[model samples]
Target: MSDAISAASLLMAVVAILYGAWYQEIMHAIKITVPKHDKQINFMVVHNVLVSRCLPLTIMAAIVFLVFLPDVIEILQHALSVLGEMGVKSYRKYDSVRTAFCLVVFVSFIIAMHLCRLTRALMEVRRKLK
Candidate 1:
C-alpha cells in the first residue's frame, strides 16, 4: 500500500511536469497575449502559474505526506488504543488518512473532468479554424 501511494504520487508529479511543459509550449506556439490588468482574466495565466509553480510544490508536499503517513498512523493508533484503555471512547476504526487520500483523488478527478472539457473546446476551435 505504501508502495502504491508512493508510485501514485510519483506518477502525478511526472504527469504534472509533462503537462506543464506541453502547456507552455502550446501557449508559446499560439503567441497569446493577455493584459495583466484585464478586467476579465483568462485561464492561461492562472493555469500557467499553477502548473509552473503550485503543482510541483503540491506534488512534493503530497509525496512527503505519503512517506510519513505510515509512521503518523501508527503513532495515532497507539495513542488511540492507550486512550481507550483509560476508559476514553476512541474511534480508531476509521482511517482518516485513507479518507483524505480518497477525497484528494476524487477532487483531482473532478478537476481533470473540467480540464477535459476545456481541451475538447480547444480542439473544436482548432478544428473549425482548419
Candidate 2:
C-alpha cells in the first residue's frame, strides 16, 4: 500500500511539473492588454510566479510523504496497540504525520488548480480590455 501511494505521488508530481511548465509558457506567449491599475497587474504577476515556484515544493513534499509513510504507519500501529492493551480503544487511527502530509499535498494541488484558473481569468480580462 505504501509503495502504491509512493508511485501515485511521484506520478502526480511529474504531472504537476509538466503542467506548470506548460502554463508558464502559454502565459509568456500572451500579451497583456488589461487596463489595470499598476498594482493589480503587479500583484497578478507576483501571484503567478509564486504559484509556479510552489509547484516544485509541492512535488517534493509529496515525494517525502510517500517515502516516510511506511515507517510512520508502523510507529502509529505500535502506539495504538500499546494503548489498546492499556484499555484505550484504538479506534481507526492513522499516522498523523502521513495524514498531514497527504492533506498538504492535496491542498497544494487544489491551490495549483485555483492559480491556473486565476491566471486564465486575468488573461481573459486582459483580452476583453483590448
Clashing residue pairs found in predicted model 2: none
Give candidates' CA RMSD values in order: 10.6, 9.3
Per-residue CA lDDT of model 1 for 12-48, tens digit only, reads 5665565565565444423434444541344444445
Which whole-number lDDT from 0 to 100 does residue 128 have in model 2?
Answer: 55
**Residue 76 in candidate 2 has what lDDT?**
61
Question: Distance from true position, residue 2, model 2, in Å?
Answer: 0.8
lDDT of each: 0.50, 0.54
Candidate 2 residue 26 Cα shift, in angstroms, is 3.5
Query: Once model 1 is optimally superposed onto the true structure by TM-score, how far is the C-alpha of residue 76 displaced, in angstroms?
Result: 21
